[model samples]
Every structure is written in structure tokens, then in C-alpha cells.
Target: MEGIEEKLVVSTADVLDYHSILEAVKDCCALFCCLDSQDGYEDKMVDLEVRGAINVVEACAQTESMEKIVFNSSLTAAIWRENICSQKDVDERSWSDQEFCRKKKLWYALAKTLSEQAAWALAMDRTLNMVSINAGLVLGPAVAKKNPLVTMSYLQGAAQMYENGVLAIVDVNFVADVNVRAFEDRSSCGRYFCFDQMVNTEQEAVKLAESLSPLISLPPRYECQGSEVYAERLRNKKLNKLVEGTAC
Candidate 1:
């Protein structure tokens, strides 16, 4: 892959420093935010993922050049500890319970939940045109190679997420496609679940587990066949309609 500097200007910036972020994208028409931090690190997570998110949104709101902002969020902000079996189906409307995330020590989920929530708040308060892509486990080869073990831990959890049917996975390329569509489509509003497929059944989960074992660290081993995973019922008519004819 070519470096970002090859075609685009690359500048050093910090998510925590609001002024720095404002300087980076304030002149742009569209901004795609994919900010995140270490999984279990509370301090870094809050500083970068949470505060950083606010800075980016505020920057968008402050900028006159901004037209659209597409924020890349995780399904973790939508799933986890919500009693998946209780809900008919999980979608963008469903938000992962914050208290539940804390109880389960799902620090990453908590960060994402708070960050996305803050982004929405900023959007509404500023009347900025913003869209969120609540994507599932983003599967890409070596995308997080800097910390493979940590990344693998996330995938290992994916087995349970898939088995429960409330979790989904999307290819990296498809994620970018969805983000672009969300920004370009004038009517694209709110959040779009950017998943290619939902593992709705026990057999499908098992297949995925085996297939992903090579990359996932200590992938989940399912012994029981759960036939009642409401996660399988997740559907995004909005995203489907958005990509009906496009490259996505």
C-alpha cells in the first residue's frame, strides 16, 4: 500500500488536543473518524477514544468547510450484556447498556458506547451532518498487527458474539465502502450496521470459529447448540438500501 503522504498531506496531530484535531480536519469537506484505544486500558481509552471523539465532533461542528462526518463505531456499542435472547433483534437502535458493560468489565465496549453517544450529542447540539457506522468485528489481515495478541483477544470474543447471534462481522473493504456511502448519500441518517453477514445459527458459529481460529487467540469453543440467538435477526434495511446498486 502507498503511504498517505504520497497523495495526501500528512500532519501530526493528537486526539486529546482539541486544537490539534481542529487544525487537521477543519478545512475538509468530509471526515471519517476511526479513533480508538487499547482494550483494557481505562486511562488511554478515555483520553483518546472518549475525549478524542468529542474533539473531532466539535471540530466538525466548528468547521465551515465540513459537509458530512462519518464516524466508524463498533457493534460493541450496540451489543453485549443486553440479554440478546430477550430482544427480537439487535440493530442500530439498540445500544449496549453502559452499566452492563462496566459490570462485565467490557472496558472497550464502555468506551465505544460513551464515545458514540457523545458524538450523537455533539451532532444534535451543533446540527452537524453526521452518520455513524456501527460495524461488527472488523476482519482484516494484519490490520492490527502492531498488537496481534490484543487484536486476537477481540476475535476470540467474536466466537461468543457470533454464537449469541447478536454479533456480526464485516470485511475491512466493505467497512470503508459503507462509510463512504453513508457520507455521500444525502439521506443517510443516524447509524448503519455495517456487517456483511450475521452468524445466526450454532452451525454457522462453529464454522466461523474454525475458520477464524488461525487468527483468533484461543477462539471460543462452543459445546452447546443454541437455537435461540436473537442476534441472528439483526437487519439493516437502511444499509441495504444504501448499497443496493453501489460498489458496496
Candidate 2:
């Protein structure tokens, strides 16, 4: 409990030193989370997330105080399909195929799938209590105060599929609230897909954006044939049940 008094947040670069991690969590519980970006580091982002989790787990095992580990995965990992609109329902069992990701150059989707897969593998192998929240396109005000435009840029549009006719949308606050709930609710295991609304095409996104705020201009429409990475027979009953009473 000596060194755990201070809270430290490390990025991918700082994780290179395993000793630093062990030292930091030597006396207290540790929680590991990652919010990876899709830009650059396409080949290594998955490995980075895996290694990051390993570092945290190893540290926790040594300390015997690591309470939980949470990962912020994306709904893109679940909704990469040619026809999500036709889907009666979707859930955690769904996965985006790497081949389709390669074809569409969907680096963000690839990052989520690879990272979550790595995390799942590690969690099972190490017997770690791990939970992941698969989130949709996060929309809200900017966290950093740097520039409003930078924040607005991300909120302005939907994914290519959403513009074309796929994927869904979730409020940033809802995603945050769910992440917190997952940590507090011991029953929260496996993966939870968090989204406020589902948008089939880019035009739909534009319409919704216009309704939300007249100032925002919708992006141009684009054609995107979704991928069928997983069989449509997968089940998401648990997630649907959870969403039944909850307000987004």
C-alpha cells in the first residue's frame, strides 16, 4: 500500500517499462482502461492494447489488489454489416470481419475488433475479471478545452455506413454512464453494446443532425456495402433485456 497512494495515468509509450507498472500498483487496486484511436498505428494498436492489459494484470497479480479491468470497445466491432437495418436485433456475439475491414479500410473497426479479441484472450487465460463496453459513435461536447471546432468535427458526421445505410449512434454521456455502471455492477461481464439510436444510412444521419442542431451540416452520401463477418444467427437476448427498461 505504500506506492498506491498516488494515481498515475500512462499512455502506450509509457507502458514499455514493465517495472514502472509493477511499482505503481504494488500496494493498491488498479483499474485498466483504454480509448484507442483509429488514426495511424493500424498494425500495432491491437498489440498495444493487449500489452497494456498484460502490464496491468501482471501488476495486479503481484499486488493481489487489482479489483477490475474495463475496456472501451466500439459498436463497430459488432455492426459491420451490409444490412444492419434489416437486423431485427444485434448484440455482443456479433463481430466485424478483418477481411471486410481490410476491404473497406475501416481502420477504426479493425482496431476495436483486434483490441477486444486480445483483451478477451488475455482475460480468459489469466482468469482476470474483465469487462468491456462496446460503444457506438460517441457524441457530445469536447472533453478537452483546446478548441471547440476540434470537438465539433467529431460530432458533425456519422460513420460511412451510417451515411450510406448501416451502423448506429449513441450519446457520449450514455456511453460514459454505462462504463461507470459496468465497474460498479458486479454482474456486468462479457461485453455490453451501448447505443442511443440506430441510423441506417448517411442521409438518415444528416436528417437527424439537422433535427438536433440546424447549425450542423450533414456530410455527403456515400455507398457502403456492409460485411457479413459473422452469421446472422448470433444471439443478443441478454443485451436486449438490459436495454428494455433503461433510458438512453
Candidate 3:
């Protein structure tokens, strides 16, 4: 866990600026592209998520010192709320429908989905070495606070997504481990769905709701009705193999 704190160099610049991103990645052996906008509804979202991705890939493409880039993406980038009901068992192969997100007012989800897609496309076009970690709602301590929605709104939405397996949960530590493993293990290819737990049963969902109580608003306990939370399953076979058969 000893990061090169002394080696760290700070720079204040815009993520969308290709030159600034290029400068940031200078002399880096590996780049972990884990940038996205929490505001899903604005022009800034497109600028930060889509354009920023392009800028980073462009910078990494130009940087000879860079080896591999680990892109931290999200389950939102893979699941659309509309498709959750109709679809069966969404996994790493799934991509949230852009049209669906736009139609339903899921701006943050759309931004993430588009951002990840653009990165994949540009990475392939440029032939850059990269791996994406499509993580669930990650919980952990933070020196830098996440966006405003990281609390109630995110938890509420995640509760709904959990019903249909559109959302899951993971510890920040576990997510970090996945990132490092994916980087060290050269054979790790494509996208890895990283989550510690997918609350697929009604009982489990209810427990989650009860635990988060006043922090998040969920339906009344009686309103839950049944114990069957069957919409889709999130699979990570490759992730298990990478983690020495410790399945999540």
C-alpha cells in the first residue's frame, strides 16, 4: 500500500484538455484512467466523461512511457433501467442502451455509458493496452468527497437497481485489488465485472434497505411483498479466476 507519495507531482488543469492530460501522463509506466463526472445532465458531463476519455486515450497513445491503462468504469455503464426488466442476466457483455438512458432521464448513467464506449472505441482504433473495471456501488472512506449524489440518491437508485441486479455493491479495497490484479496479470483481457456482492434476493434487498434506514429511502417493509428479486444476474467468471477462485 506504499504509494510513491514523494514521486507525486500536482498540476491544476482541465481533464478535457488533451495537452494537459498528455503532460500528466508524462514519464508514467502505467496509467489508471479513473475519471468521470458526477453531473450527468450538463454539457460538462459530456466534456468530462466523453471528451476527457478521448483526451486521456489520445495522451496515452502518444506517450511511449505508458504501458497499460486501467479504466475504472461502473455498472451504470453496463445497465439501463428500461432493459433491466426485459433483459435476462446482464453481465460484462451488456452495454446500457444509449437511447434508453436519453429517453428515461438517466443522465449520469448515460454519461458513464458513453464515456466507457468512447474509450473502448478509441483504445482499439489506437491499439492501446487497457482494461476496464465495471464496478458496483463502491463504499469506503475518502479524503476527496465523491459527488453530491454519492449518499441518498445513489443509495436509493442502487436499491432499485439491486432488485433487478442492475446494481450491486463492493468494498473500495476489493475494487482496488481487482484493478491491481488486472494490471499485473497480463492475460487479463476485456472488461471485468467487479463487485463483492449482488443483492439478488428480496430478503437481502430488505436487509440492505433496513441497514441504510434514514440515510436512504426505501419502500415500506410490507410493500416489498415477496422474496424473489429475479431480474438479471451479474457474472464475473474471469474475475474469479483472476482472484484465485474467490468468487464474488
Candidate 4:
């Protein structure tokens, strides 16, 4: 399929800066996808993201031709109910509690929740046609360069969760594909969860890692078990219907 026009790729060197962001969105449609690792013990990273998103939305509203906006949120924004374990169904309505996030020290979840909330609030206030794509752990072919934190903390060790489990994983390519589709599809609105399958334990992660890349050493199975904070059962009926009419 033909790719999006190069003119559509509005490069903003300073996404978090208000003046710079506003300058980038002038006379153009904007799609803002936010991804940062504030997981584990990090405290203020999430707040930074929330502030940046607000700035971006404000900037976009200033543009005369800015038509739509898309925010990449996460499944972490939802709350997983332990008491309702028997009920496997999950959807966009589920939300992760900020208070619980503070207690558990799940910086990633907190960041996602806060950033999404800020975006929603701003979108409502500004009356911007915005949508957020909430997804699970994204995995695919490794990028050329690997950083220390990504290589050691997140990629190498599988000693986090112990039982139960977290949400599923989506390939990075699938993520990019869906993102482009979301912007092109006029019917796209609100939050959409993206994950191919669920990975419950470190054992399962190791298996997946081995299959995806045989060279990498798999860590001992550990359970980073967390409740499925967001519901995974979101109807992609709109997405499907849109894709049918347009190129993916």
C-alpha cells in the first residue's frame, strides 16, 4: 500500500515545548502518540508526559486547519478487578486507579493513566476531535541500538511478575499499521485497545522471546502478575469497517 504523504509527517524537534509544538501543527492535521518509560520506581516521568500532551493539544487548537488528533494511550490506564477473576472479558471502561498506582509504584501505569486523562480533559475543553489508542506491551524486531535500561531492566530480566499476569503483546509493526489506520479512518473515536494475545507468566514470555529471537537468552520465569487494568474486549467494529473502505 502507498504510505502517507511525506508532507503529512510534521516533524517537531521539540514535542514538549509549547511554542515549538504549536508551530509544528500550524495549518496541518496532528497525530500525537506519546510513549515513554516511567515504569518501576520512576516518579515524575508520568507527570511530564501529561504536561507535554496538554501543551500539544493546546498548540493544535491554535492551528486554523488542524482537523483531528490521535493520542497513543495504554491498557495500563484501566483497572483490573481481582475479585472478578472468573469474568475474563475486558474493555475501554476499565481504568487503573491512580491511588493504587501510587501505592504499587507502577510508574508506567500511572503515567499512562495521567497522560490519557489530561488528553481527554483537554480534548473536551478545546472541542478537538481526538482519539487515543491504548495498547499492551509492544514487541517486535529490536531496533539497531539498545539502551542500558531497555536491555537490562526491561528486556533481560523476567523476574517481575510472579502469578496471574498482565495484558497481551502487539508487534510494533502492527502498532504502526493500526496507528496510521486510526488517523485515516474518519469513524475512529475514543480509546481502542490493541493486543494480539495475553502473556501471563515469565515462562510464557520466555517462550515468546525464544520464538521471536532465538539468539537472546531467556530469563528464569517470573510472574509480574498484574490485573488486566483495561478491558481488552473493545469492539474494533469501527476500525474494521473503516479499513475495508481504505488502504491499510
Please list the residue runs of candidate 4 whose C-alpha ends up more than 4 Å from where it truly belongs after superposition: 1-12, 37-41, 79-87, 143-165, 201-203, 209-248
The lDDT for every candidate, in the order shown, is 0.75, 0.60, 0.74, 0.63
lDDT of 3: 0.74
Give each model a TM-score.
0.83, 0.67, 0.83, 0.74
- Lowest lDDT sum, 10 consecutive residues, model 3, at 143-152
Give the clashing pairs for model 1. 165-231, 166-231
**Candidate 4 at residue 80, lDDT?**
37
Across 27-82, the per-residue lDDT of candidate 2 in tens digits comes to 55536465454343344565675576566555555667777777777776766655
Predict model 1's lDDT versus the native: 0.75
Worst 10 residues of 2 by lDDT: 227-236
lDDT tens readout by residue for model 1, 55-165: 899988999999999998888888777576566767778888888777766777777888999999989999999989988767676555554444553453465576666
Error of 3 at 5 (Å): 3.5
By TM-score, how accurate is candidate 4?
0.74
Backbone clashes per model, in order? 2, 11, 0, 15
lDDT of 3 by residue, 23-112 (tens): 878888787777754542553464467888888888999999888889988777887756576766677888988887777666667777
- Model 4 CA lDDT for position 8: 49
lDDT pick, better of 1 and 4: 1
Q: Which ten residues in a row have the lowest lDDT in candidate 1?
A: 38-47
